[model samples]
Target: MNIGVIIIIVISLISIAGFSRPELIYKYQFNAWQIKNRKEYIRWISHGFFHADWVHLAINMFVLWSFSKAVIYYFMRSLPGNSSIVFLVFFFSAIVASSTFSYFKEKNNYNYNAIGASGAVSAVVFASILYDPFRIIYLYFIPIPGIVLGIGYLVYSRIMSKRNVDNIGHDAHFWGAVYGFVFPILLNPSLLGHFFNELLAIF
Candidate 1:
């Protein structure tokens, strides 16, 4: 079983559990106040395993499923035997990295809470984008290059994060995407040149 499928199954099961038990979501969902004051630090990683609703869960899992294979393929090519370990670390670390900004921003706001795998999912997506910049990604039924969509996503997330106009964790999405794109380059700096070469090929 591939790591991505395992992740989907695990997250789906936990999310289903949260569906049946609202209190589970309340306890595990990202709450900066709990982490900061109560020291419930596990929420940093735990929140990514559950979600707000079926739709939310479906969307995240779907995106993860779609992008994970490509990311894993690239990882395997780059790191060989240690690729799975590296991929697992990348995924989980992205969850924590994505939430770090929110933890600091909302530490004092007890009412602020978020639940979903979107942060980690965003990481997977942007990682795939790094590998295949010119690949087509259908956004709301419109076809666009992966690189274009990635840039647009970052811009939108940044704007919305600043606006703070909705319940969506735009900050998480922004940071997760950034971490996803950077983590691979950090692992193997040569990948940065490969990314640029891929872009140059299309232009």
Candidate 2:
């Protein structure tokens, strides 16, 4: 089975369990106040495996499934022997990286809580975009170039994060997308040149 599919299955099961047993969410959901006060640091990773509802879970899994194969393909090309392990590391690390800002921002807010795989999903998405900038990304049946969508996503996330008007973790999405685009370059600096070449070719 693909690593992405396995992740979807595991996350879905855990999220479903959390739906029936709300205590699971309380224990595992991202609560920066709890981490600061009670030292429950595991929530950084645990929260990604749980989600608020079926729509959240389904959207995350669908995007992840759509992009994981391409990202892994590029990973295999860039770091041949350890692609799978590297992909897993990339996915999980995004969860932590994505939440770092929120942790600091909400450390004192006792009422704040969050749970979802959006960060990791965004990571996979932007990583795929980095690999193929001109690839067509379908949003609600409308096709948009990956580079265009990536820029729009970043702008939207940044604006939304600053507004702080929604329960959605826009900060996580922004950072996760940034991390995804940079990770492969960090591993193999030459990929940065490839990204530029692919991006400019469409012009």
Candidate 3:
């Protein structure tokens, strides 16, 4: 878990300086170059690893660390020896999905830019809901059912998107949650525990 977090931190630090050291990594930003270039498409994954400030980085990390291990755990227990591959798939897919959504949505807003793993992190959080829908997420001081929290988050992002908020890719957040919602439902197919029993046999 520490290694997972360290990788995210290093990428964020290298990227966070985009505000101050644009000369070095500007081309790597998730903007025109990402939309235009082909070979450097990995920016879709790389961009999700960094954030703009301490608070931004901290929240992203807390969510990633809090939920990702559980995500990996279930996959590993179910499909032993395949944890790494599944994780890679879930991770990279969320990133690319989020990135593609943002690129198409932001083509005209030249000032639009994003710098957080919230989209991918949102995937992890909502994935947890698929596993445990009744679970509680203390999203705020008040306790809210995790599913409600997830839906609330989507609504908030959608509202923010319509308002044309600056500097935030609300579309990515909404779609990432949408991805998280869809991923396990497609994979597991049932709210019952049957998915786990069969999934484990795959190992």
Candidate 4:
């Protein structure tokens, strides 16, 4: 099994367990106040293992599974040694990095809490887009190029983050997607040139 799928399975099981045990949610879910007052820093990464509901878990897993191979392929092909380990680091760190902005922004709002893998999934999706800019991605069952979907995703997430009208963690999604695009390039700077080359070819 691919590392990405393995991660999905692990998180799915944990999330399912969390659904039945409210305490699990309380213990693992991202709570800005808990971290600020109690020093429960684990919430930063632990939150990725829980979700608001099964639907939320399913959607995030599906997207992650869909794009996992592309990201893993590019990483293994371009980087030296232990690609799986490297990818795992990229994935988990993204979960935390994506939420760092929110942690500081909401730490004092005792009611602020979030649960889901959307942030990590968004990171995986954008990373895949970086590798295959012209690949086909289904947007609401309609075929659209990956690059187009990526742009739409970024814009929508940014706007939604600013509005904060919904419970959704658009902030995490936006930052995660940004991290996804940059982390790989950090691993291999050549990817920056490759990204531009593929982007221009899309014209």
Which of 1 and 4 is ahead in lDDT? 1
Off by over 4 Å in 4: none
Q: Give TM per candidate.
A: 0.97, 0.97, 0.79, 0.97
- Tens-place lDDT digits, model 3, residues 17-70: 765765544455566344554456656666675567668777777887887878
The C-alpha RMSD in Å for every predicted model, in order, reads: 1.0, 1.0, 5.3, 1.0
Least well predicted 10-residue stretch by lDDT in candidate 4: 78-87
Give each model's whole-structure lDDT.
0.92, 0.92, 0.69, 0.90
Candidate 4 residue lDDT tens string, 1-203: 88988998999999999989999998888988899899999998999999888789889989888888778888899866677888899899999989998999998998899989888889988888888888899988999998898999999999998998999999999999999999988878998899889989857
Instruction: Judge candidate 3 at residue 146 and give its lDDT.
Output: 78
Residue 104, candidate 1: alpha-carbon lDDT: 92
Give me the displacement of residue 120 in model 1, in angstroms: 0.5
